[model samples]
Target: MSRRLTLLVSAAALALIGTPAIAATPGAVSADFAQTSVWGGGYQGQYTVTNQSNHAISSWKVEFDLPAGTTVSSSWDATETVSGNHYTFTNKSYNGAVAAGATAAFGFVAGGSALPANCLLNGATCAGVVDTTPPSAPSNLKAGTVTTTGVALSWTGSTDNIGVTGYDVYRGTTKALTITGTSATVTGLAPSTPYTFTVKAHDLAGNQSAASNAITVTTAAGSGSGSTWPLKVAPYVDMGSWPTPVLTDTANASGLQNFTLAFVTGNGCKASWFNAYDPTTGWDRTDIDALRAQGGDVTISFGGEAGTELSGSCTDQTQIQQQYQAIITAYATSRLDFDIEGAAVVDHTSVDRRNAVLAKLQAANPGLQISYTLPVMPDGLTSDGTYIVQSAASHGVNVSLVNVMAMDYGQHDGIDMGVKAQQAAQATHDQLKVIYPSKTDAQLWGMVGVTPMLGVNDDSSTFSLANASSLATYANGKHLGELAFWEVTRDRNACNGSLTNCTNVTQQPYDFSKRFEAFTG
Candidate 1:
C-alpha cells in the first residue's frame, strides 16, 4: 500500500505489564529460592512457586527479602516489584494457574549480593517439603565444535526432586544460558582464546548442584573477518516461492549458518499472520524448518519497508502483544528483529506500547535475543530512532543489536558507500554510550550492526561489490553484532534497473553475499 511492492510500511520493539499482588495471603503454596551465578556485581537467581494444596491454584504470589544491598534488576515468569530490601513477585497470566502439586519456575538477574530470605506465598510462609539436598553435578560436560567465536556444548543430565527444570552454563562466572536442555550453543566468545566453562543443575525447589567438571577449550583462530555475535544474511528466498528459496542464486552453499527470514507482518491493521511479500498465505515453514534440521537457524524479521506493524495493529496492548507472541510461538526462534521505519517510527503511542510488550516478553523468556533495525543518516539515528533505542534500554529490553540502514541517504551522489556506512556505524556506537555508560567502546561496537542496500540503492547510488568487501572488513575489525543487506534474493548481477528487486551493476552472482558472509560475527 505504501512502496516496495505494495508492502505497506514499518515496525518496532516491545514492553511489559503486570498487576501488583494483593496483600500477602499465602494460601496453598510452597516457594524455593536459590542463587545460581554471580559476576560483575550482579547475580542470577531463581524462585520456584509450587501449588502444595490438594487443589489447583489458579493464581499465586511470592514475596521475599533480599540482602541489604541487593536488588532485582531483571526478572522473568513473574511481575517483580521491589520496595526497599523487599521484593514482591506475582505470577504472570501465562504462569499464574498451577495444577495441584505443580511447580512454576521463574528466574531473575539482580544487582549486588544475592541473599534472599523470608519467602512467603499467598500471604503464608512457604515451607515446602524441605529438600535441602542438591542434585548431582552434571557429568561428561564436553565441548563440541569450537568456532572462531563460539562453541557447542553437551553434558549428562542430573537427577533432581520434581525433575531438573534447567541447567546453567557458566562461562567463567557469567551465566551464559539457563538452558532447558542438556546441550547449548554459547556464542559471543573471543576468537583464538582458551576459556573455561562449567555447568550446574537446578530443580523446582531452589536447589543447585555443584559445578560440573570444568573443561577448557580454545576457540579456533579466526581470520581477519570474524565476530562473536551470530552472523546472518537476510530476505532468504521470497514469500511467493514459499520455503524453497533459491539459495544457489546468491551466496555459496557451504558454511552458511544463519538467515533473517524477511518480512512477516500483520494483515493491514489486523496483526494476523501473513507474509507481506505475498500477503495471501501464512508463514511458509518448509524451508525454515529444513534449515534448522541442518543446524542452521533463522531470525524472523517483522516489518520491512512495508506492512502494518504489529505494534499498531491492535488498540489494546494485551491484544497487540498476543499477536506478536503468536508468530514468535509458532516459529520458536531465540532471536527476533523489528525493522522500524515510516509511521511506526513516529507513532509515539504504539512505540510506548511496543516497548512495554517487549519488556514483558524478555522477562518471560530469558535468553531471548532482540535487534531493532532503523533508518539512519550517514551520521547517526534520527531523534525518533534514538528515542526507540533509549526506550528499549529504559524498559529493560535486552537488545543485542541495533542495526542501521546505511543506504539511501538523500540520493547524495559520488559518495563512498563503505565510508558512509562505517561513519554511520561509528555514530551509532557513540549514541549507545549514553544508554550503556558501563560498556566499553569495544562492547558498544559489538552491540552495533549495519545493514546496507547492495548495488544500486533506492536513491540510485551504487554500492559496488568492492564496497561490500570493505564494509565486511570494517564490521569484522570492529566486531559488530551483525552485517546484513536488504535482500538475499537480489544478491546477483542481473539488474532490471529496478533497485527494488536486484543489483544495479553487472557482475558475478552471490559476490556480495560471499563478501558479507566472510564476517562470522
Candidate 2:
C-alpha cells in the first residue's frame, strides 16, 4: 500500500483496539466533569464521556444540574441550553465517530450568586466535585524581618487539580514576579519603603485562581552603596511605539517588576525636542507619577539612530544648549544618555567642545549624570584621529561609560568582529584606568543587541538568550558597570528570536514612559 494509505490503516486499527469492558445499562452514557474556580471571575468546567456501548456514538448531550444560586452564563465548543438555574450543553456532533472503547467531552459555563455544590453531569451524580483546587491562602506573605534595600517576601504553596504549575506574585496592584513550582524571591525594592504583596496559583491549563491574602512589608534603609541601586527586572514600555497611554500601561502590566523607561527623541540638543508626551491622550506626567508611586523609576533616552530626528538646523550649539536645559529642567531627571552615532559628522568636533558642553550642564545641575554612546569600532579609532577614551578624560568630561554597539559592528563585519570589538573595548577601558588610576572597572558598560536574526553571515553571531546570559556573566566577572541593549523591542522572547526575552539576565527591558515615584517602605 501507499505510505499515506498505510498510515490511515494503522490509525484505524489503533482506534478500534480496546480492553475488556464492564457491563452497563443500555442507552446510558457514563459522564465525568471537572470544575475549577478562576481567580478574577468565573469558573471553568471540563467533561469526559465514556462510550460503553458496542457501537459508535455520533453525537452526545451533557446536562449539568447546577445547585441553588447558580445560572448558566456562556460556553465554548458546545451549545449551552438553560432552564432556570441549570445548564445543558449539547454536542453538535463529534468530528469523528467515537468507538465503544473511546471517550468524548462537552462542557458549559454557569453564573450564580455563589459556587454550586453537588453539581451533576449527564445522569451521573457526583459529590461536591473533585478537589482539584490548587493550594490556597499564601500566608506569611511578609517581607523578611531583617529588612534591607531588598524586600524578601515568602508565601505558602498552592494546591492544584493535577498539579500546581507555579505561583505569580504581585506587588500592590502590579504583577512583580512569576515563580515556577511555588517559591520566588523579589529583589531590588527601594530602601525604607513599604510594599504590598499578593500571590496566586497557576494550573497546568494556565488557569490562575484567586489571589492569596495580602500583606505589607517595608524595606530597610540604604547604605549609600552602589549595589543598593534598585535592580529590578521589568518589562519594556515604549510610549512612542504605543501612542495610546492605555495600551502602553497594559503592555507594562505584563512585566510589572521590571523598570519602565521611555524612549524619547532628541536632536542631540535638548531632551524634549520631538516630545511624544501628551498630557490628556498618551503618556504624560500622570503616567510617570504613577510609576514612581509604585516604586519604579522613569528614564528618558536620547539619540536613537533608527528613526530619530537628529539632523537639522537644531545642531547649532545655541539651540543645542537651550534644548538641553529645557529637557533637564522640565523632566527633572538626574541622568541623561546620549546615543552618539550617525550624527558623528555634526557632533564630533573635539573632546574639548564635548567636555565644555557637558561641564556647563553639570555645573548648572550638580547632581546630573552624562553618558555617551559610541559605535562599536573594532579598532577603537575615530575618523578624526581622536582617541575616544583619552580625549573624553583629558577634557575633564566624565564619559560615565561607553555603550559599544557590538551588534552593528559585528554585522558590518562578522562574528570574528565581535571578539575584536570586545578586545577594543577592553583595551580602551584599560588605557583609561592607566591614566585615571582611581577609575574602577565598574564604570564600563557593554552594549549588546539581543536579536535572533544574525547580523553577520556567521550563525554563531546571532544573539540568543544563552548568548545574553553568557555575555552578562562575562561582564559581571570583569566588574563591568552593567549591560544595556539597543532597544528592548528587538529582544527575542519566544525562543524563535522574534519576541523580547524579559527573563534574560544580560539585557532586561526598561520602560521609560512611567513616572519615578519614591518607594514607600
Candidate 3:
C-alpha cells in the first residue's frame, strides 16, 4: 500500500466514528484528490467526486489540465479523453449516476514532473467537495467444486450509499475476472490446480469495499486419458522506456490477452528498496491497475538481459526470501516469471537459493504458477538452462512452465529463425519429459513455452512476419503451453536501428501480436 492511500483510508475510518463531517453547502458538488504513489518522473493520482444536492445526478464529468510534458498513461472507473494539456473524464455506464450525498472515485497514472491543477466536476470547481467514507465489503463468499476447466463462485450482495455497480474477482492480487452479477464462473483453469479466490464490490461513485473472505478450491484431477493443453499468448512489456513507449499504451494497443512485466531488479548492489517498482516513466501502480481494469492479466518477471539480480545483493536466506515476498504481495499475481540471463543463470548458489525461495512461495500461495525463461540453442537448452529446470524439481519447486528464448541462437549461420525456434521448443520438450518421466509427451509439451524476438534480434537474425505465422500455426497444432514475443513496445512496422528495442524492419503495427494472437483458444 502507498502512504497516501493509508492516510486517506485512516481519515475515512475516523469520519465513520462520529467525527464532524467536513461542511459543504447543499446543492454544491465537490471533488477530493489524493496521490497514491509517486516516483522519479510520474505519480498515481485518485479523485473522488461528490454530489451534495438533494436530488440525484444522472451523470457527471471531471476535467483538468496537466502540467506541460505530463501525459495520462492509464485510468480506471471513468472514460478519459486527452487533448494537449486538457483531460476530460466521464462516468462509465455502470457508474454514471450519483445519488444525493453520494461520491464516486476514479484513478489514473500520468508521466511528467507534476500533477494537474484547477480540477472541475461538471464545470464546477471541486474545491468544496469532501467525502471520507468507504463502502461495506460483501460477505458469504462460496466456491463450488472446481471443474477441470472452470470454478463456480458466488457471494452475498453489498449495499452502498449510491448503488453497487460491479464486482472484481482476484485469483491473488491479479484480477482474474470482473462482472456485474452476484455469481460468476471462471474458466480457462489448469486441471488439478489449487486456487484461492477473493471478491470486492464497488459502487457507482467508484469507492471499492473491503475484500471478501478468501475461499480455497482445487480443480478436478485430469481424466488421465491424455495430456490437456492450454494454449495462451502474452507479450513482454518492458519496465523501462525502451522503444520509447509506456506500458498502458503498449498494452492497450496489443492483441495478446496477457503481458509479462519485465525486469524488476536491484538498482545497484545491496540497494535499499529491494523489489521496489520504478518503471522507465516512474513508479505508478495505475499502469498495472488500469490493465487489470480492462481484463488483461500480467506476470511479474524478475531479471533481464542486464541488471543486478536481487539475490546477488541479498545473499542471506532471510533477506532474499523477503525481497521475493515483497514482489508477490505488491502485484498479487498468480504467475511469476524469472528471465535468467548472464551471471544470473550461471551462479549455481543463486540458482539454488532462487529455487528454494520460489518453492516456499508456491507452497504458501496456492495455485501460484512459476515459469523460468532461459536461453536456448537451436538443438536444446544449454547445460545451465537444464540445471535451472532440474534445480527447481530437485528442490521440490513445481514449475508450471519452462519458456526458452528462441531468438539469438548464438551461431545462426543462416538457419530460419522460426524453424530454429520450433526445433528448440521440441528439444526443450524432450528434455522436460526426461526430467519428469511420468508426464506424457503432450503434458511435457504443454509445460513448455517459447518466446521469439520479432523482426531483427540482437544477433542480427530476423524473425519475419511469415515466421511468426509459422510459429503460431505450429504452436496451435502441437498444443504448446504458451507463445510470446520479445516485446509489445517493438511490435511495429518500422525500426530505428534499435537491434534490441525496435524490430528495425518494415512491418505493420502489432503485426507480430496479431500473428501470435491466433494461438489463443
Candidate 4:
C-alpha cells in the first residue's frame, strides 16, 4: 500500500472513535464513474472510492467493469490488472486509503472502437455519463439563393457539453471564413452571379459540431447600361446666405435641389469655420425636415480659403477620419465634400494618406458618398497638379463627384490669366472623362462663382459673369453636370448693380433667372 493509505486509515480512526467500531473494515468501493475529458479516439474516466465501515481501511482494491466495445487503455494511482472487459485496481502505497467518512479518487483512460454504455466502477452504477464528444453531423445541408459574387448561409448551432464555439464558414470544400460570434459577410463577390456557402460549429476542445443548413445569394445587376451615361446635376447653394423667404418659399420660385452650409474657413476668405458644429442653430432636424419638404438635399461644405479652423497645417489621417465620422454621425448624413484647395499650401497631398483617410471614413460609415472640390488645372501638367481628381482615380477611391473650382484658379498666380481658367476647367472635364471611363458623367461638376465684378469692358483680360456663362454653355454642350455659385448675397443686387442686366450677376436667382431656362434647355 502507498504511504497515503496509512494516513487515510489514521485519519479514519480518529473520526470513528465515538462510533461503534467494527471488527473488520469494509472493502473500499466507488460509484459515479464518468469520462471527464476526451480527445480524438481517446477518453479519461474518473471515480471516487469510499469506505462504508466504522474502522479505517489500510489496503483497498477496486474492480471495474467496462461496457462492451471498450477496453482499459491505461490506469493511474493504482496497479491495474485486467481480465477481459473487467479490471482490478490495487491501490498504490501513496493512495491506498479510505476512512469511515473519507473518500478517494482514481482515474483511467479507456479506448474503444465505438462509444460504450452501461459502464460501472467498483460494481456500482454511475450517473451523468455525458457524451463529451462534439455534436453529430449537421443534417439538412442545402444551398439557397446562389450568386456569382456572394452567398449567405445559416445553420443550426451545434450541441456540446460546455457549449459550441462560433462557426467555420466554407465556400465549396475549401475553408473560406471563420466566424467566432455569428453571421459572416462574404464580400468581393462578382455581380449578377451565383455562389454556394456552408457553415459548421466547433467546441472549446476543438471538436466540431455538424454543419448548418447551406444558403446562397446572387449579386444584383450592374447599374450602368448601354453608352448613355448616368449624369446627375447637383448644384451647391450657400445655406448661410439663402434668402429666408426663398428658403421658406414653398412655391418653388427659385429652382434649386440642395443647399450647402459653409461650416469651415480656408485661406482668409469669406468661408465659415470648418470645425464649427451647431446642429441646433446652424442646422437641425427642423432644417432637414424643411429641406426634405422642398425636395432638396441639405449638405455641409468644409475648408474654403478663409474659413475658420481650415488654415492650420494638415491634420493627421486619424484626426481627419474622426472629425469626418463625428460630423457625419452627428448630422446623420452620408454625403461629404472635401474642398481641399488649400492642400496646395500644405505639402503635396499624399495619395496613400488620402486613400487611408477615405478608407477609414468608409469603414466607419459604410456606403458614404464622398466628393472633392478640385482645382481646375489646364492641360499639359503632371496629374498630381490636379490633386484629388487624379488621386481618387488612381487609388480607386469611391468618389461620388468632383466639383471643379473653375473660378479659383485665377486666384492663384500660375494659371490666373483670363481665358486660361475657363480653358483649364474644360480640359479637366475632358481628361477626367477619358481617364476614368467607369465614373458617371454625373460625378463631374463645374464650379462657377458670382462676384459683382466684370473683366475690362473691351479687353476681356479680367474675370466676370460673362466668362462663367460661357463655361456653363460649354458644360451643357458636353452633357456634363450642373454649375455651383458662391453665395446668393454676393450675386444679388446688394453686390451686383440691379437685377435688370443680371446676365453676369452674383445672386443665384438674378444670375440664373434669365439664363436658367436657356442653360437647362
Per-candidate clashes come to 20, 28, 6, 38
Compared with the true structure, what per-residue lDDT tens digits does model 2 show for residues 1-521? Answer: 22111122243443343111222333334455545333234444456666554444444555655666666565666767777656666664333235666776654454553444434433334211222345554555544332343444555676654445456788888986664433344544566778888888764334567888887777766443222223222223344554333323543543433333545554344344236442112225444434433444444555555434232324465555556665554434445555545654245453345456666676665435455555545555344323544556666655544445555444434345335545655655654555566644453322221111222222234444444444444554554433454334433222224222232223333221121111111
Give me the displacement of residue 102 in model 4, in angstroms.
Answer: 54
TM-score of 2: 0.43
- TM-score per candidate, in order? 0.56, 0.43, 0.62, 0.44
Q: Which should have the higher TM-score, number 2 or number 4?
A: 4
Candidate number with the higher lDDT (1 or 4): 1
Residues 194-268, model 3: lDDT tens digits: 888899986544567899999888887764522332327877876565343455666567655478877777654
Error of 2 at 19 (Å): 95
Among all windows of 10 consecutive residues in model 3, the one with the lowest summed lDDT is 15-24
> Per-residue lDDT for 419-471 in model 1, tens only?
89999999999999988898777768878889888788887787888898998
Q: Which regions of candidate 4 fall more than 4 Å away from where they truly are?
A: 1-235, 239-253, 265-276, 279-285, 308-316, 343-346, 349-352, 377-385, 408-422, 433-470, 497-509, 513-521
Give me the runs in candidate 1 sitting further than 4 Å from their true place.
1-228, 232-255, 268-282
| Global lDDT scores for all candidate models | 0.69, 0.46, 0.72, 0.48
lDDT of 2 at 335: 52
Superposed on all Cα atoms, the candidates' RMSDs to the truth, in angstroms, are: 19.1, 20.5, 11.4, 23.7
TM-score of 3: 0.62
